[model samples]
Target chain A: MAAGGRWRQTLVGFLCLVLPLVSLWYHGRARPTPTLVERGLMRLTSPAQHAMSGVVASLSRVFTDYVWLVGVVEENRDIRRQNEVLAGLVQDREQLRKENRRLKELLRFKGERPELQTLAAQVIAKDVSPFHRVLKVALSAGADDGLERFQPVITPAGVVGHVERALGRYAEVKLAVDSDSRIATAAVGRDVKGTLVGSGDRGDFLATFETLGEAVAPGEEQRPLEAGDMLVTSGEDERYPKGLVVGHIGEGPARQSDLGWVYPVVPSVNFRTLDLVQIVTDHISTAPLDVPR
Target chain B: MSALGQSLSVILITFFLLGVESPLLQELHVSSFPPDLALVPVLWLALHVPPATGMVASLVIGLIKDGFVMGVPVGMYAEISVVTFLVARFLTSKVPIRGLSSLMITTMLLSVLASMLLALLSLLFDPAFQGHGTVLRLAGPVALVSAPFAPLVFFVLDRTDSLFARSRQRDAIFGR
Candidate 1:
């Protein structure tokens, strides 16, 4: 290379290394949070922001509830049909109850269930911009409702999202199905653990395993992640309670050559029509509902 | 009255326009189309006012845009502002006419360019940026939906300036 070109390359190399270090130094020295004055101002403004956020959240909840109300009516009909199928089984329910009670006793012997307090929150406003898929929810209750940040929000359909921003009356829910969002999840039936990521496309997700080298196929096959396979949170994230219905495996790449499963999932909640959700704020376990061993 | 006031007006106008385009008003369902009205002010300031004013206007508006933008981080707006300000400055000398046709063509090109640059910048920083499909899915429709409001914005801004100028001239004549 020419001497000038060599010098230019050297300068560029120096710049590439030096600029980031300078930026790092500058950023490291700078405070990440607002200044005292700014914080004071923010404190004053926060209530308004909270109120506006609440309004947006309530709007999302209203839409979600309206949609979910329709869904519940549909689901109630399905439940009525299933109830009839279960009706004949109800005669044998005493026998099944004994068996279920026995199984619950065994589970009770294993460990106590967490104490769970659920608050029904309504979807108020949704960031339905194709870019952002966040739903805000307002609780009929507030801090009095015992809602807190980092709580898991779910619908009867399944994991709807989680509590992001929380106020006395409302909170912002970042939905599970957001393509950019990830939640720690476990594959049901097979007990495989992985991180579930939203793929932006509806009814699809990508799960990367804690480790790889598991053979997989698409379709339900009495095993975890057998495509059509169901999965749920194992409380590994500690944000969500264990066993909340996440989604079913839509597809998993065959023969993982690495420490990960390329598993796709079908999310349970129809985010577009999601209305009412339950916030799992209290982890109540080993309650009287538990069948003692 | 002063150069600083002249520049401050441009910056304030740009800032106000940025807020106008924000989702805050979309929350109200006021205007059918929230114009990307920043361009009119930027174009006007760059052409009629000083280049320095235009540059500052771009930076203030860009910073506000970045700060308020939910999806992207800050500084991308600042970078775009600098680039757009420079580009507008360069193009001003090249383009002779400052008429409606020119403004329309300029707005179309600049809006498209800003969107493209934003996409490129976003892609460079974010891993999820490969989803150009998603950005286009959002920005393309938003730009198209919001484009028709640009001329209307310029019309109002022009009237405001003319009216203000008329008042100022009358004051001077009346020695008030």
Candidate 2:
């Protein structure tokens, strides 16, 4: 090729490559909507993402464990100061006590029938993804302790996620808030029931109700779901047990569709660096349609 | 100082500013975040190095990062690092990197550009990618992180430049 022609060819080649990228930029910038291609890309990149997640999880675990020493002192001082500052908190404690009692009753209700071994783990990480919110945790015991995959995980805050990947000493819990995680959840109050789907972003999940008359107010809290709401497994789907805390209702608008109520949930799992987590090893079910009472 | 020493100075200073300070600022959970550590290092390299050279450095660093902790595609960082290097190089030469305010402003602009580029690539290729907050959330953080660290990085680079006046070409190529 002539020098001029070669230069022209180079320019065209560059444009050919850059044009679609520009187009993609425009498309991505226009809206954060995912397309079929994007979904395929996510799946294709899952292994790499998973591996990176493990490295980060391990590193973060080490970082947090070491930091905990200094954190204990700061925490103690903060707690002591709060105790002195809010001494009158005891008067209001009565109402909190009653609420706590009711919550414990509910837990006992759910825990009584579970056939699997349960281990409680503390949250050590928060969601790292700016887009999809998934939580990972460190187990007090690993497979050596009989922890297995697909076990239902929970927190008093709510249904966090399940074990996505595991090793002999460590396992990764995929938070319910992950865009890929879907659960058949029901809004027990007002007889409004629907399928709760994770939206990846907190306050963005879809609670699709089939009933046409159901009403939801978007951005309004229908109820006082605390920062730590108990999420129990609803065995309706048979994938999980009868009452594992799935997630809590986060801040967002509840849409009242002619069909159902969709409430966006704020996941309770601290996804950044989960320190401790509980695994329910024996709760997987074969049936998919049984509704939980 | 030797050529290797100059290059080492640049990468070391950049790494310290980015890997350490960026996360610390994020932990502070401040409303307006500053420039990130990664962006700061990438920007510094782009300004001081040639495009081709910067591109190679970006690819190497990005691959190392993929091996390190990021939960994204393997080649994604390599691609982004090159683009960021080119953009910063273009902006620094065409605009100005002489004054602190100009440097800060340029760094801020470059950080935003890098963020937008990463965000775009992420949405396209990373299925599990959930955007942090809007650009608004990142801007404050970027400004906060990069502003204070800019002088420190510049000072180190300048000292290394004087120390290795003989091997200036290597320093230029390596962004030391």
Q: What fraction of the reference interface contacts is present in each model, in order?
A: 0.03, 0.01
State how far residue A83 of model 2 sits from its true place (Å). Answer: 20
lDDT by residue (tens digit), candidate 1, B2-30: 43564566566555554334334445543
List of chain B TM-scores, one per candidate: 0.72, 0.72
Please, what are the lDDT tens digits per residue for candidate 2 over residues A1-293?
67986676456435433543543444333222333433333333333344444555556545644444343566587675565446536635865786577557546734754554666554333333343444434455334545455567765445656765444334456666655566655443333334556565444333222222334454543542322232344466655666444555555655655454455555445544334455666654532322332
TM-score of chain A of each: 0.53, 0.46
Number of the top-ranking candidate, with DockQ as the measure: 2
- The model with the greatest TM-score is 2
lDDT of 1 by residue, A1-293 (tens): 77986777466434433443333233223233323432232233333443655565467545543434344456487766566556546646775786576446434522433365677666554452334455556666433645565677876566777765555556666677666566776666564677676665522333333322343444433343566666677676667777767777765563343455566577876775555667877774323311111
